[model samples]
Target: MGLAVIDKSLFRFDGVRQRMGLLALLSLLQALCIVGQAHGLARGLVEIWKLHAVSTLVGPAIEFLAFYALRHFCDVAKQRISSKYGKYVAGQIRPQLQEKIFRLGPQALASRGTGSTVTMLIDGLDQVKSYIEILLPKMTDMMIISLVILVGVWWQDWVSGLILLLMYPLIIFFMVILGLAARDRSNKQYAQFNILNTKFVDSILGLPTLKMLGVDKEYEGEIYSVSERFRKRTIDVLKVAMTSTFALDWFTTLGIAIMAVFLGLRLVNGTMPLFPAMFALIMAPDYFLPVRQFGDNYHATLDGKNALHDIMSFIDSPETPQDTETKWEGWKADSELKLEGIDFAYPVGSKPAGDDTQSVASHSVAMNAVEQQRENEDDKKSDDSSESKDDSKTDSKSRRHRGRGKKDAKPIEADADGKAVAAQALTQPDALHHVSMDFKGYGKIAVIGKSGAGKSTLVNLLAGFNTPHAGSIELDGNRLENFNVAAWQRHISYIPQTPYIFSGSIADNIRFYVSDASNDDVNAAAHEAGLDEWLGELTDGLDTLIGEGNRGISGGQAQRIALARVLLDKSREVLLFDEPTAHLDIETEYDLKKTLLPIMENHLVILATHRLHWLANVDQVLVLDEGQVVESGTPKELIGAGGPLDHLIGEMGGNQIDQYLN
Candidate 1:
């Protein structure tokens, strides 16, 4: 509500304070021009009242017009200075903010919804620019121009000066009160705007899923509801802005009217001359002009102030720690990774404890409701067994409490006596904890776990997408502080369940990791990834455009493209697959595996999956439950021993060899 305090930060921006000083000087000069114009006009009018010749008034009238022109020239100069500087500052901030966002990575971006981040970068910066451009000149004028005009009026006629001066505090009092109301309302409106943006983006992204479930109309209604709420909030802010404008206008007009009445009486009684009375009357309005303008522009600055705060907060957020100085040659066939007492948890969404948190929470609830409704409709259409399986997975994931509460809920442990007992107090709720493992000269090591059993978390940690809170990782006998090192990431190819197809030609997307790859190299990689036949079908072959807004490729084709990217980049010898085939149909999955298995022969592979069939291909198996490694060994050994892997194989509908054969 106290905008003045918040707005002070604008001065700290580079060149803003210096720009303010120059604008203030210009405002002072403009104020003098204003007084000269008023004086000239008053003289012309007084001469006319005395029944003087028209020729006699020409000089004074010309003087008035000249001063009026000069005053506007100053205004233009001030605007030009402020606007260019504002744009410069905006340009500087945007890139720095973007770089910070990139450094924070996808996990951070997910925590702060994509819609909100996009809005802050685009609309938010635009608002701040507008605020800076307008605020600097207006603020300078209010401080300097008003005082100059008031002094001029006092010099012409003291009584009129006293009356006009008395009105200043009264006008400001009402402005402050209304300004505070406007600020509060505008803040709420801005927050609502963020919600509307987030919901719109989410709805658009999920439109395909909504249509499939036949609940697109329900989501549309939800969007409309959010839009309506934003509209109402906007109206509330406008009402306060309008009231402030009205108050400032009323008080200034009242003060001018009083000054006019007093000067008329003095002139009638011969206590004041015609020239002085007219001059005083003409200058009264100019005295209040700057203050009135400031009040009118108050609402415009509110958004800018809020946006600056948001941008600053994002820039200050803690980034994932990286040891930039560490040098390692690269991953190799004999390279070994030893993770000792590894622990990790998804970071919680830390919202400020005020209206911001409440607003985001409310929007989150609405979004969740929409998602829940869609899920329910999907459930109705799904088979009973599939629904039961999905429900079980959901329960398991919920127990992990990823990004849920304030503290990390440590999973209870079992003692030697097999009694359930509390584990050591953990600082945060962990997605993976005490996950010690060793991988040397990896052929194919399969990390098997149900949903919420920390499979993806472990993969993310390995790929440097996440950093462990407490752990030591030694790669190739060198003590590694964290996995997110640039040198380490360069040697890894991460293939997720759904691979991202960047907007470009087929060859370009395939050659993403190896930008310098030749056409021959791309063709060879595509052939290996099983995309050669698909490319032949296209008119442009390797050059065929794909991705958003281009030719829509099939899901199988997208996966192949991701594989092609990995294949083209020969520097990357380490492959990390996080259930790349989980979403494919059984036939498609089987076909892709035929292409995938052959490529894994020489590379060090760490594949996280729930599919039982992949176990046959993996040389070693690591079974995880509740973030801990429960059992690990060769598939034949685990099966012969009849332990955790055997039980999991039964849960996955028996041995996959029989299913494959059938």
Candidate 2:
């Protein structure tokens, strides 16, 4: 609609400008051939009307046929050139978009939504390709061919030329008005389509849960409703587009009728010759042809224009701040990490005036409740945080977990009417607030917390998936701005409750962290992880293929595969476990602990869990309540001191003492 959406930078895509120039030249030549064909046909018709000799008509007929063939050849060449250039541009953009998506990481993708991102990469790019191919040659033809035909008509008869020229602006004025309407409607339709796609994908991904809950039928009905809404929106946009096309056709046809009438009147009055009147009549439609076709194709290109806008917006999005200049060696046995006054809060949506803090606080509370519920549910399964598996589902949930650590001072505020206001506070909260901790050398430290107590948030921050908004971190006596630094992450192994099983052989999954590991090394790591018995039972043994959409494996087996990965990568000295055995049954947990205890020796291990039995093996315990460390000491000292750790053990039924003894 508006030329602004065309994006001038698109012309710079590879060889677009060069190809467009070439096409324009071809179009100009084609315009000349069109004029020649019209003139020759007019001359032949005039000769026939005059009863001229057959030989005279033969020359004009041959000339007309030759020009017609030339015009079509030029058209074919323009199409071929434009099509190649379109494909090249699309190929170039697809990879760049994918790379950007990767660099932006799960945080960005979660904000953008998975369905929308996938649609942009696949369907959006395709629409852009089609737009580029059709628009280039069409634009050039409108610019070059239309003017040439107009001048040719003027040469034959000025009256016809003047009439066609005046109608140009009239057609354009109507096109712009109708084009804007179509653009508005089309944009709305596209937005609805994206919403439909997002809902569909979310439903499909959660289909298993829906079926388990017996709500699959309800979800299906909702999907159908959304689809119907999208269909209706599409029809609305088409109606406007078709109306615009009809208007353009009407104006062009009216202009042609007027030209023919004028020419006939002039010829009857003996002011114009037969050949000239006929030639002008023939060229009138050709003169207006380019603009009319452009108007018709305008709606077709609207999707591409919007798609280009979406792609450019994504490419231009600001990336999370990362420090790339830091230099340091990997973590070691004596490496120390300290956090001082660390503060963080989940980012909130834009709010209206006078409601900013209140809105954010309420949203934060709602989000935290939802996150706690999800984490509790997920803890019942496996705690795998791999991008290929859980990132799509958990990324959004995790964002809500990033909130201020301070407990809400005013849990409920009252309005003048004595009715409780949902959220009425000025202070903002952080997921971790003024929290300080010290970890040094090789030993096991357990971080214990209830749901929404910032356990996962701390893990995410340490894994470099999130950055603290305040305070500083020190690693091995070197002060660091953030944990996202590459030098530090390379030496760390993070194993969640559920480890992701990649689509590959059992041996390949074992060697994930160390791709060049020999068969002996793989077998040794698997033995350490207690996977030897399972592998022995398999017909293919180490060569067994398993993962999503492949051979099914138990949660315990997946955790063992993850353990093997850590065992294979001996260079890693720092291990972070977020409830690695939370999803396992009691027997499986006991077995996993036997394997994990040996690996925890002589390594800096930080295990966050609700399982109180872990306290028996840990050297130091850091107890967290509402996101702050309430107690820190050796497990023996904190166990029966009636402190936060003691309270937590009591809440878990106090039977953990016997379990720990066993």
Candidate 3:
């Protein structure tokens, strides 16, 4: 908290500093009163205290402005600082954290607990707000008070001043030892908290699955265990803190005892004047009081340190530099895109650079099984020679065809359409191989690939969320590197997989990007997104409140609301949709897309989706294998290739292409 306060607070010659100086002056006068009494100058000290106390009282009123400066002006400074820089330093940091898991891609998510990640992102980060805002300010105040203490003690009695100065190291030494043990415990607690949060979120998200698996609800037990563990560890942290404070208190008592002993000897031997000695000894502890309080307040700083470890570690994880001089231009306009030797891989050295298409070996058995079933009937008919021969000819044709030999399979290149894209990267992963691509004449383009194929990476590039290494991606002839980030963003709308709902009405949510958009304009956008129907169902209609997380709304409804928001952004050239309807039902998905297509005309709509059925009408479909584009064309053209994509379509569609076509 102390560090953050120092980092954020602009200490100036102005209000807060001046106010602190006044407060210290008041303390100094009080010190003089004690000294004057000890030295038999009581009448003079009394006159000084009366004269100073009035100004001391008024000093705090003037200091209020400085406190306001700390709170509000500091926020303004952050804005001014970021504007000279690119915005989204905070927003960009989060995606890097989530996307790191993404670059580790499917494997990371699969192995790690989802509930834990959710806790870190949502609750854990939120918890840090207090430490940053409140505790930090208090810490600064404490430090100032400590300085006042040292000054007051030094002026009155050099020996006592020396003792006050020595108090900090003695206190801090013990606190440091306690802090070391506390930090280890804090780390363990954070890990446990993540696990508990992960479990809770998973239990909620997959409740149906859990119930289906006949798992008796163990939430109470789980909560109890988590609470108990957190309580134990939190207590340990607090105990160390309290113990440190008590140690500081003990030293403070000893210092007072030493001062009393020295003062008693001086008085008895008449080496020191009685009033002066009495006043100085009494004021000595008061001088060092703030030091004790500082030691007591050390826990706030410790908590803040831990919070920083999490915040800074996660925020700095992105490979995207906020202020890179590098610029990109001349790539895709809308859905038109081109790739020139673009290769990307996970930061780690586990996977080879390849397209997202599946391997032939992966689908061969299933294709052969279907072929054998088709050929079985004719094999028993001795009289059906021509039919059997025709079947044999068909079989040979099927075998000759590459890929899983499944109906309408594009190729092995579409191993599968994986989730997560560059748009989602809060930070780019380290060592992202020289990824480069070019796209032009963009439109309703379908971005498809298997899990971990870098679909999200592509979307982020298009959205200008990240800059590729050793390569360039352009939108509307302006490479991501060259586009006016603010203006280009204004012209491009993005609907993320996880849509955010502000604390306002549905109208506010839709008009979030366009602050001045009229209610009618908001309604029109809702209509285009197929949210009109849902809005009409509510009494508030467009004004319906959408609490955080869209608490009462269905997932599909929330998705539609997000789509409505993009429409309201009034983007001219492009709209990036990251799984707009992944959580929607087929009926809602069909109706929503049906309404959405016309509005998407003229503007490029690049969507990443796992379900290829809704993607049939897209202008161009790029099937990625790992990180390379191995097969790309219209749905028909790709299916004609007959490989990874086709086999996947068959298996994913229950082995019948017609299953989804309807």
Candidate 4:
């Protein structure tokens, strides 16, 4: 059971093998000292029984004390070795795990939830450190010290050694059974812990919303329910842990008691000498000492073992291949970016590759899906003759409704009101299916779509935050895999609906992209972003702190700060905006747009938005519906062509907004 929990990856850490060897040597020395100390005490007792002189007693007593001290000295050495090495291994893994998380990005973490990720970064690593510190020395002791002590006992009296050996298997058998139970319970407890963390963090983030909706108490009750489940799981684990400790202690104590009876019987029969009998009796407890201590700590280290597996699995998960060799001089005025046959799908679930059960389940599901698809195709073939006339009409309508230049595009569907409504929900298999687009030179391009029409998903793909499962991306005529290319991403800036305002001064936030920007540069960038008026109202101006636990700012103000970051970093010539004005009021949106329009000049901009008014400002417009581009042309060409763009504008009340502005 002790060896089963020891992960092979544990040994992969630097100095782990060397430290294990050192601990083994120390355990052996400690074992020898135990035997020597026991022999000395037995010798002193045997001498006292013989009525030896006081001077004769002095030598045996000194020998016993010296070996006893040396045994403890070995223990101290082992502790120090394991302690320092455990901390070192943890230190090495921390940065690697953090870097992996950053590289994976938020799209990958969305399934895991915020609280769970935070717990893994903080509490999970601590558990791994504890597991290492405890497991290493204890495992070495059980392997070396226990065997050495057993051999010592056998040399003294084979009868007592035989009794201890017979009891060893029984102790291990019971330990294994209980250890498995403890492990199962511990897994549940850990899963529940992750759930609790996720829920807690979500609740905290949505606290204000809950209060406004007057449903804070309802969510509070839900949180209490999750907390109670976590508490019950914890108690169940502790129960199994206590039972394991008790069972180990019981069997070991019984073994020692039985060994004492045998030793006494042999002594009475006059078969064994007094010195050897006493030595075996003294060594009996030490024989079971390692096994007992290991069982005691087995439950404690289970959490760490589970934590290590999770951390290792997360770091080892597959990531999109980053392009390293492609060297293009950044985005230029005449540069072009093109994508063809780009496809992407969210993974079914966040199951790690190492999980055998999940792997088998996923394989079975995939096979079933394939079989079902084949069955459906067979059924369709059989019904083709009966539905021939209806299919002909459907195909004719499909050809008429298909967008120009689309490859095998599905016809856009319309409702009774004659509005194009092909919005695809996120639960579908494909987020963006067979999506292809082309951009040349520096210009503003607006991608308009309804909710769940893959607007943000498309933007994320372009920004390299999401990777397509199948796609060919070409940049300046250089064929590429995905936009995860560092050279490409380095030249792009992403601004979501709500820009993150990390705790710092306004100046520091402005210098986020270019950290070493001078005070004058930061002020100039802020002015360009239209933050000069806001700064003038503040007492400390650019030095005023904001973000978490500080003065709060409006959504428009945060957007301006994000623009300031872009203005400060002139090197990033491409900008990807995902509904950047979706959360702001109309007035704030208008003001921010006035500030943002000039910044879009002389740079390639891809803006994904539901606000159709942006079409008036953009040179080209692409209307997406159900993960496919249903319309693409200059605004002057597509606006009133009675196509998907006209349908979308009618549905979103774009004409009314235009009237209000006019």
Candidate 5:
């Protein structure tokens, strides 16, 4: 909090600059009204019978416009600040978060679910606008308002102003107490709602695998449990919020009652003038107006503060050095690449990737998804093993047993805390630990690892999504930190295992990785990635709409489109593949490898794969175990060593040896 307060003080953050400017103008108008009206009314009341009540019209006009302008200013300021600061906070936080997640690499991304992060980043960040724009500005406005209120009261009558000001400390004190109570309940409600969001995201992502396993019915139970908890907590928050409204109503009623008593006593004795006393009575309730709303709006502000808490949590999160440059004008200018001794551990209790409950739940769902995939692989392995054994030894009943095992062993893991905990491990499962290596951008290299290996993390790091914890990673020999994040992004032609598509035409997606790409360039890229064959079949060709999230495209088609995007980005000096052939059939994989190799040969091609046979044709192979590079050399050299490759090959069986050598 001390740090946060200090940071805020230093920032001069212009979240509500435009609105503040407007608010200042509005405050000036109000000040003139408050100052002018009091004198106008006083003068008119004194000389009323002499000049036909001229002060009545002038004084009322000032009062009406003063109130109107003051309220309007506050309203506009709140809205404007909310919009601007909300966007400002989102824009700054999103990329940093995405980059953080990206750094965790494929292993990290895959271990988590997507739905939660998407929902949190989209909706959760927005809820915080009340604080970033409204409460923060209002807090400042309150200070100035208090000063103005005291000054106006003093000008009218030092005695009345002193009485109001002296008594206000108690009112402010009670308000603070009310605010504290509201904040406590509101924070709990916010935390529970986030949990519910995480659970919902988990439910959605795991729906497919759950359906396959005939456990779809269970989702309702899970969702219901979360919803019930959320609903109850929301009610609790609302009850506390309403408590403030009660206090406000009471204060207004009591304040007016007190004014009546004071006026009655003063009027009977003729100790005070009629107009001044009346004006003071009217202004008494006005003193507590902001307080009334403060009590009611305090809960909203509490929500805002929680949202701010989440955002600040992200910004304050320990960051791996960021790769912010969009275009690496000239990396490796000193040397091609360099890496120092690397050692890293997950930062504990730290938001490893600044992912909220949504992202964490998404990860949980994604991990659960792995269960189905693993089951399938195990089944295939069993089938192949059974087939290789003599036909006489085969039990037809065994196939059903194998299918059941696959069903039970499904790929994705659903225990929410399981993935959350796993994601926190910097070196969980097959992550690299103390190993380090570097190379220039002129050649292709393969990073090979089986299921739990950190190949994906390594890929993300090279792709500039992450920062190394202990060792320095450099591009073109310049320290990674010194590199601009946005600029370095331009250095890679990236092709994901599962491709992404926008809700636009086929042409739009292909052109995503390139700017102002001509028809010829698009067509050329499509053929290079072998997407033209599919395009030739489409009547609309490049203009065909792909729908949101690639709704219309088959999995293979999506991968192919992604490949075409890789080709289109001629500006990128490096190409990265994360199990590019992981999903393709052998025949298709072979064809893709055949086409992909040549295009990537001239650039830096870093491939992370589990398929051993593919390495036979590659120039270099990097074998990962835990999180370290256990073995790295030419594939031939490693195969001769009878090391990690031999182990992976032995598990794959003899067919790989013969097929790969041939």
Candidate 6:
């Protein structure tokens, strides 16, 4: 809308300052050429009007042609400079964004949907590149070229200059109004675009299930509705954009027309000479050219401005500090990972002070939804309950509990059999509260909790995707601030519920972690993962292509590929599974469990699951409630002990399963 809205952060890019300066210089020189062309053309026309010989017009004609060509040459050079720099800046920003997202880990992915992240990486960067390309030269032209041309017109004739001067503010005033309108609409359009992308990607990923459930038609209709909304938003933005373009053109055209009328009247009245008057008339359009060009592209650049802000905000965002300097050997049989009084909370806000960074809100959409839902439910319960005094006391207690630091924090009161009472609701400030635990050697431990009980939060902290606000973690007696050390993570293999299978052959996917793994080793690992029969069934064996756009594999097969990767990489001595079989059928889970248990041997396996049967294979069970450890012991000690684990087992029908099996 105005120069004030232009991103000053653009100057921070390498060579941007130098390139912009060069563009300004070029624009200045080009403005001089424009004046020369106008003067020479006017002289040539006057000579022709006086019935001069063709030979007399040669000099002025030559002068006009030379300046005209030179002016356009400068224009081309400026464009090339701006465009090349735009691409260079885009190239520079892409990898920085990728690296930041990579360092942030799966927590970043969960916070930012897979669809939105991909769109930002691809389409958003492209928009920024286009914005840079169009903005720089246009800016220089408006600042330098327009001013110089205006001075030249005033030198030719003051009246025309005054008319141009009056029109400039009017044009700008209208432009600002229209630009503001367009900007608001464009923002809404961009938001709708992101929503559409997320929903589309989510639908595509779940298309198989939709088809199987015979609800594919209904889901298709939902996508159609989303697409229609996006289309309408886009059209609204386009309408504003068109209106802006028309206003710029109308005002600039009117100014040139008014100047022509005045110049013609003066010439007819014999009060003005033909040369100066004609020159002013010739230069009138050139004076308004830059402003019109900039105004025209202003709407086009709004999306880019939004995207650049998003990217810059994300890049500037605070990340959990990594202890890269810490020296630690790989995990060993006797190595122990201990946590003392750990506490964590999701970041309160995504944006830093004074910055309108969309990345935070985009990333935290799902998390905020979950938190809001919890708060709403809590409020609903409070309203429905007749025990108003008890509710008030509970609220007061929660407030007091939140005020205390983890050091001063005491464990929530426990019931009989050492099972912890329900702690504060997860909607409280902290996701994890005064949590403490220890993992030693190759012991297998399962962390069990209901949804929102901080199971994923704990795993993320252990994997170094998150940092504890209050805690001391020690590995092998080496005091550590967080588990984000590269040396430690190098030995850890994490498998989520839906392990991503990259678009490649089965062998290539298996060799992901250990790239140099041989075919024989890949085969052995695949066999170990119980994929040998499947691989044998395929004529291409391990070389058969899978993943997106290739042959589709079952969920079980994808899990097998993930296991094969871990097995092929002998260096990974720690396996972190966050419900790897949660999506699988019962029969498939049993088969995968058989393959998984053997691989879990001689490794520190931390499994977070809702499946109670896993307790039989684990060395210890930790029951978490409201972000704190409620009860923990060997499966045998807690199964019939009327503890949290036992209660959870009964609620989930695990006791019935156990009885039926026995």
Q: Pick the candidate with the highest TM-score.
A: 6
Q: Give the whole-model CA lDDT for all candidates, comma-separated.
A: 0.74, 0.72, 0.51, 0.76, 0.58, 0.76
How would you encode candidate 6's per-residue C-alpha lDDT over 513-627 as one tens digit per residue?
A: 9998888999999999999889889999999998652248998999999999999999889999888887789999999999999999999999988887788789988898766
In model 2, pairs of residues that clash are 346-402, 383-498, 403-430, 403-431, 404-429, 404-430, 404-431, 405-430
Candidate 5 weakest ten by summed lDDT:
385-394
TM-score of each: 0.76, 0.71, 0.61, 0.74, 0.67, 0.77
What lDDT does candidate 4 reach at residue 316? 78
Model 6 worst lDDT window (10 residues): 384-393
Q: Rank the candidate models, highest TM-score first.
A: 6, 1, 4, 2, 5, 3
Clashes per candidate, residues 3 or more apart or on different chains:
3, 8, 73, 0, 39, 1
Candidate 4 regions off by >4 Å?
Answer: 43-61, 202-228, 267-274, 350-428, 444-450, 469-472, 495-569, 579-601, 609-625, 630-662
Q: lDDT, candidate 1, residue 251? A: 94
Against the true structure, candidate 5 reaches a TM-score of 0.67
Quality of model 4 by C-alpha lDDT: 0.76
Q: What is the Cα-based TM-score of model 4?
A: 0.74
Off by over 4 Å in 1: 1-12, 199-229, 353-428, 442-451, 490-625, 629-662
Q: Judge candidate 6 at residue 13 and give its lDDT.
A: 87
Model 3 TM: 0.61
Better of 4 and 6 by TM-score: 6
Worst 10 residues of 1 by lDDT: 383-392
Off by over 4 Å in 2: 8-16, 47-66, 206-225, 350-429, 441-456, 489-661
Clashes of 5: 39
